[model samples]
Target: MDSLRHHPIRFHVTHWSDDPFSRGAYSSLLPGGTPEHRRSLGEVLDGKLVLAGEACNPVAPAMTHGAWNDGLRAARIAIEAGARRVLVIGAGFAGLAAARHLREAGIECVVLEARDRLGGRVHSIALGPVWVDEGAAWLQQFNDNPLAIHARQLGLPLRETDFGQPLAAAADGTLPDIDAAWEALRAGIDRSLPLADGVARYLESRDEAVRRATRFALDANLILEACLPLESLSVDALDEEGVGAGDRFLPQGYSQLVAHLAEGLDIRLNRPATAIDWSGDQVRVADESADFCICTVPIGVLRDIHFNPPLPPAQQNALDHLGMGQLEKVVLQFDERWWPVSPSGYLRWYDTPASFGEWLDLTDAVGTPTVAGLIAADALERVFAGRSDEEIALVACEALQAWADALRRL
Candidate 1:
């Protein structure tokens, strides 16, 4: 649409995870000790020192909405204690949200950000003639997501993603029979429901139907394909009965929401907190100014940075043990529409190495027909880190070609 031409203003975004203050965007935990590590890392040294991040949230950890909720909770706790002046660190959604909540409660507050911009990891980039989301693009599970309410209030239009005919490819230069496989898989997934309700429908004997259905629902291959392992993501999390995974997006930018939230607030940009010194009732932060501190930095930063008097030994251990994985978004623009056979926006190519992930068409999602992205985690770190954009584009193009060949077989 090129609104910048008409509106005379354009949306800009940058990543907070790469910033020194924010080691990474969202929090992701390894398999074991996640619960214990969460409790210890976020345990308040005292009522004066409070911690809030997406990681601190048990129910909805590693999500923007979760981080916002945690910030509000932390601020409320501080406010309840009769703290006159409060400071929120990091100008991302969490910090901005915390500040907004504090302001609503009539508490004096300020937000500190390491980067020059807000939005944290929600970076929106322009690809050729169109703008595309480079980070945290999806507002997943919109039913329970309060962000939608805020979006509506801001007059932001939301739309659902259309599943027009997804294509699949294999890494071995072969295309798995995607349609047939998906049909079988869907049927398998669907048939489990009756088995799930067998106890209620046919109560002839003690039925273990629920247990069997639960096992099938938590299939290993399904979880792997979804990126997370079976155990980390629950079947209940997927079903989310009644709660629609009605994912919605903002046309302007996800960062626009962050910018909108930051308006009418005191936010200091390019201020990275090095250390936290909470000796007295009031916490002190290390920056250009030795002023009141509210440490709202990401957990990854907290783990790496030094703190005076040292965190509790157990907390320190948790910080040391907690590891952050490298998640990357590689975008490419095609010279021509090579994907002729399938017209879907989503394409899953299983044939590529683990480092190479499924190909996604950002055209429908972001109004950019020529653009797409490869969503890979730590697996692609070695490949993506040192490569030039042109090289990356070539690799992506070749991957797509291989994927297309595989699809032809199917």
Candidate 2:
């Protein structure tokens, strides 16, 4: 905390774990699971009820665009089925997209959101003059992503982010040859080896210095990007779905995309649906009844909702198999930018892989003197469990200071 005393403006930390509406950050496929599980989960129930969310999207689960695409898919299905009106639960990207597409198709729809806000996991708040995204911020695969296309159509300014070349800095300023280690890891992955086990075995065969750097890079990347522990991630899935070429960010914030989709849609905030009944001819969400119902709630939230007559055995099984990944971010605004002014976006700490392993430079992205520290999975749980805002801010500032000190030594 003393490190940040020199330059301070206003700081805020948003912990999604404490959010009752979300319960967790996003979805992640457990080991021995395929994208087919998500596809099966998206299957329509009773011909009048449908599931539409990131969890249902097989192509890109756990992404805002995935939720948006799934909503569009469900909306198309409802339209083809001759449904006049549809009830959408949750006002996140999925729910908003479904309602917007349905409205465009001339079908009436209503969206019920548990929280007062419109964006579910895509929250953007103003820190003084600049807007910073507290949730889903980046638009991965900008060239092909529909969300990116929509952003362009809406004339939203998108700046290319340096996700490919993240600064790998060590505390003592003596970094190892991580490139060679990464190559060896990739070779092992190509041979169809298990992620955690294979990486561990591969590191043991290498020199001590090389092994340490390799292990740090792999673990840091996995935790920082995947938001899951190395053991929990699937090697096959990772290899199959290779990292996107690049990523783009909205300078203003990602909330613009949600706001754009919400235009002309009937979205009711603070209307949480505790019960859903789709057994009969008409589908009912709580007290309100509609011809068709599209549930876009997250998997974490779905487990809690009471479904009358119970959901199909397959759907229930899918819920049991999939897991939610925990990720936390602490954003601190400074009076002036003290970090490097390079185009690079990320600073990965090799030493503090368990605490704040990664720091994102928002100066170029949002033009604000702000940096966001990211922690994921078990590390996030350990560090942020029941911690107050002051405690979190102190830890975040100290992590930033460590990186700053490392840069100075270099």
Q: Judging by lDDT against the true structure, name the best candidate.
A: 2
Which ranges of candidate 2 are over 4 A from the true structure? 1-7, 177-180, 189-195, 198-204, 240-244
- Model 1 scores a C-alpha lDDT of 0.57
**Clashing pairs counted in every model:** 5, 0
Model 1 lDDT per residue over 240-347, tens place? 121115666665668778878888998888877777777665666653322234566777787655666577787766656344334455566544455644454556
Q: What lDDT score belongs to each candidate, Candidate 1 first?
A: 0.57, 0.79
lDDT per residue for candidate 2 within 1-410, as digits (tens), equals 55554445677787786687887788776665567778889998877888889888877777788888999999988987789989999999889889988988889898999999899999889988888899887887666688888899999988776766777567755877665666667765533555677677776667877777776667565555667787786664454342344677788989988888788889999999889988788888877888899998888788888998798988877776577778888888887887665467777777644678777788867767888887888887677878888688777887777777777788
lDDT of 1 at 113: 81
State the RMSD for candidate 1: 9.1
Candidate 2 C-alpha error for residue 320, in Å: 2.3
